[model samples]
Target chain A: MKDWKGKNLIFIGGGIAMPPIRCAIWYALENRADYGNITIVYGARTVGDLVFVDELDQWAQKERTSVIQCVDPGGETPEWKHEIGLIPHVIERSNIPAENSVALVVGPPIMIRFTLPVLDKMGMAKKDIYTSLENRMKCGIGKCGRCNCGPVYVCKEGPIFSFEQLSQLPSDY
Target chain B: MSDVIAKDDLLRLVDQWLAEGKRVLGPVKAGDGVILYAPLAASSQLVLEGFVHAANSIKEAVFPRSETIYTYKFNGHEIELSDVDPDSTQCIVIGARPCDAASLPVLDHLFNWDYKDKFYNARRAATTVVTVACSEYDDNCFCTSVGLGPAAEQGSDAMLLKAPDGWYEVRAVTDKGTALFNGKTTPAPEIKVPISDGPAKKFDTVDIETFLKNNYESDAWRDITMRCLGCGACAYNCPTCHCFDIVDEGDAAGGRRVKNWDSCQFGQFTVHASGHNPRAVQAQRQRQRIQHKFRIYPEKFGAILCTGCGTCTRNCPVSLGVLNTLEAIAAVARGSIEVK
Candidate 1:
């Protein structure tokens, strides 16, 4: 209830779901004084799939925030010196403190499925974790019935849902 | 006071509408035991007979299958964009079934929710829907199960009930309906229409809605959707299934943006750009279809997204009906099985 000023911001983004998180990253940097310690753990199938490289570098260079990048095994290049594995494995190994942290993750479905459990083990409650669903939506409004999860239209009700909220919906998507 | 118009007088109304150069769409005989809404030029063409409702609902009267929301033109170097205005032309829609008529208000809640869809709103404003009460029943019709009736005039401007002796009782329900009278009526008090006998309620929706939420992770989804072809014939023909995709057609310089009907039944509906599909299989898609109508839409809109029109089952190749799906959920609600 103390607002986001003191909350540690963790954004786990990779692949195509990176843009929205990158937008959030820029917002956090612009209003950096409004937030606390920021950590971004991002990964991909390969270094080539990594998005927002410039921004990632900028975050890594920031004095307060930490940016950890990773690539799947055998996907590392000669220039790559970071961790080699899935993002959750990297974060678990990096040992970032989970106290007072609210993490927003956006990535492939498999990545989300694996990453959330890792965050849970780090002491993050289901309510503290958030992800958006782009569930095959149409009519961005609720009129179109395509992107629904257990009576919730992902387009109108969410492009965003917390882990606790996701648990309440049907597991169709 | 309400009055009755002769069945012949109704035809004269259609003729007058056609003479006025206004868009008149009504049910016409499509084939044996089938009727579809189409442009009407003659009163003789209206087929307010047989079937629970027309093969298609009155949805397209407001939200079309595809329409240009914005038009963009590129001339050599410069590009100009124009906004498509809501249709202002007078349009009269006659012979919509009670369930189909009820769909307009159901759709109103959604089109107006989150953001107002002006394209749909415009057509809704321009069109006056007149519905016929049902006197027949089909195996697929189930409006009663979802809180609507065979003769419920929830969205109609005019109510046309077929009575004995070839007489049609026309009750003007709204200002638009009243305006159709133009201050003329031959009050025929003897006109009486026996209430329409609607199809039996297949399953209770309240029980189904509750049971569906708790069984999201259940395996019953796979068994129910195993034979699904994902043809999307249901979504397309449904009066309340209003999913649409916005696409930019043409070239990079300038292209017109169009909204086309999209379906949850397709695999591409939830595929990410990284080639990952969350609802990767038919069971998931089928789960999405059921939960949307029974559970999700109700939570947000306070109404079921289905009219129980059964157009989907009627058109589906596999004969996979929504009634069967609802019954399956009802079975779960009765505690016979957990749907797991």
Candidate 2:
């Protein structure tokens, strides 16, 4: 993220996967001058399931930042003004710019699976899209030998990887 | 000229080390016609010959099967953690096979790779390995396959080869070995101990590695490893299988965090809390073991994770050790066998 100065940072997260995305947003916002426009597209199954409600409102009002919050089709309430759809579908409807933009995505496996092709179709290069992986890690180092996708240990080499890097690994995880 | 020590003298040296309060481990004839590396109480308990390889590797000297890393105690509002001192008693491993000795250096890379394991490092530093070169081998022995042989010395502080007339030709490899045998050996320029040309190369490691890299999704894994019972006997007996698990054992009051030897062959090894298992089947687990040893470890650490000791094959319940598996893989690679 530090390497991509003056580039737009798009964060897409789904239910319970907001922590890492939140962290990256904090980093980008703290160093506001270092990055270009920041966009956050976060969603949950229902309005009650959504996290950081106050923070989302606070971020939306910040200069050069936009927050798009949503819920599943039946999950919206009467007072809800945000979008209504699955996270991937919501991201598709958002019409996010892919040029000179990096996407950081975090979500459940199904959400990630559906969201990846959406970003790809939006003209985002595989290298510009990143995600975190989790495996049954024991040692948290490479020695325990359980957490690996081919030669790469998710604990050691990465819990974070670019889509391009993930493509090179076997789908063991 | 080669330094020689009589068999009697070597046993006497073992006694001397034991008397000096050093932990001495060597091969002994355990009951039921089994040979294992165990702590020697006296020199007479040491079994110098009559086995190709011990049932277990000498790895327990440094990495025990289970060890307490730290103990935690809980108070009303605070917790107290106590660190266990890694045993640093001066230790000697006598009569270890060359394959067993070689695993030490291979393991050294892992214990110190990124986060230096203080427990492993401390014990490793205090231990000295004395290897006995192979004079005989059985069908299961394949040290030659992986670029190691009968007398190949990689991690031995000193190596002892069987010489004629009840004497051992001692080759001091490190300063510790030299110091141990200082003024104890008699120079014998006339005698030479003959070493065996280890097991024939079963399969090329490069070919195995290439096949592993290219054929991740092949049906050959399921076909070749169908009979593997997932017993993990192979991993337990392997000289270089270093996978382990860390667990906190106790109630709410708190207990000790322990590291225990783990195997990739186990079904629960890679199961996530969410009930998803990546390597879900026995074939996938078998493939993981081979890939880790042949391709992954070598690529990451620049050293293969196998010593080709054949201990896994020798100890496997079914006949499917690494050698058999690799042979099948070689057959697959050559198109001699087809997986439908």
| Cα lDDT of model 2 by residue, A1-173, tens digit | 78878999999999887876898899999999999899999999999999988999999998899999999999999999999999999989897888999999887766776888899999999999998776889889677888898888899889888889988988776
Candidate 2, which segments miss by more than 4 Å at Cα? A29-37, A44-49, A57-86, B251-254
lDDT of 1 by residue, A1-173 (tens): 23556788998986766787888888887788777889988888898988878878888888679998899999999999888998778878888888989999998777777788898999998999998775665557666566666667677678788998987766645
DockQ top scorer = 2
Pairs of residues at least 3 apart in sequence or in different chains that clash in candidate 2: none
Q: Considering the two chains of model 1, state its CAPRI-style docking category.
A: medium
The digit string of per-residue lDDT tens for model 1 on B189-296 reads 776677855778788777787667677767888877788999888888888887787888878667778888888788888775667677889888888778877877
The CA lDDT at A96 in model 1 is 85
lDDT of 2 at A116: 83
Clashing pairs in 1: A136-B269, A151-B295, A151-B296, A152-B296
Off by over 4 Å in 1: A16-37, A51-61, A134-139, A155-157, B31-33, B75-79, B182-184, B335-340
lDDT of each residue in B1-340, candidate 2, tens digit only:
8999999999999999999999999999999979999999999999989888999899999988998999999997798899999989999999999999999999988888888999899999999999999988888887898899999899999999998889999999999999999999999999888877878888899999999989989999999999999999998878788889999998789899999999999999998776768889999999999998899889988998999888899888888999999999999999999999
Lowest lDDT 10-residue stretch of candidate 1 chain A: A137-146
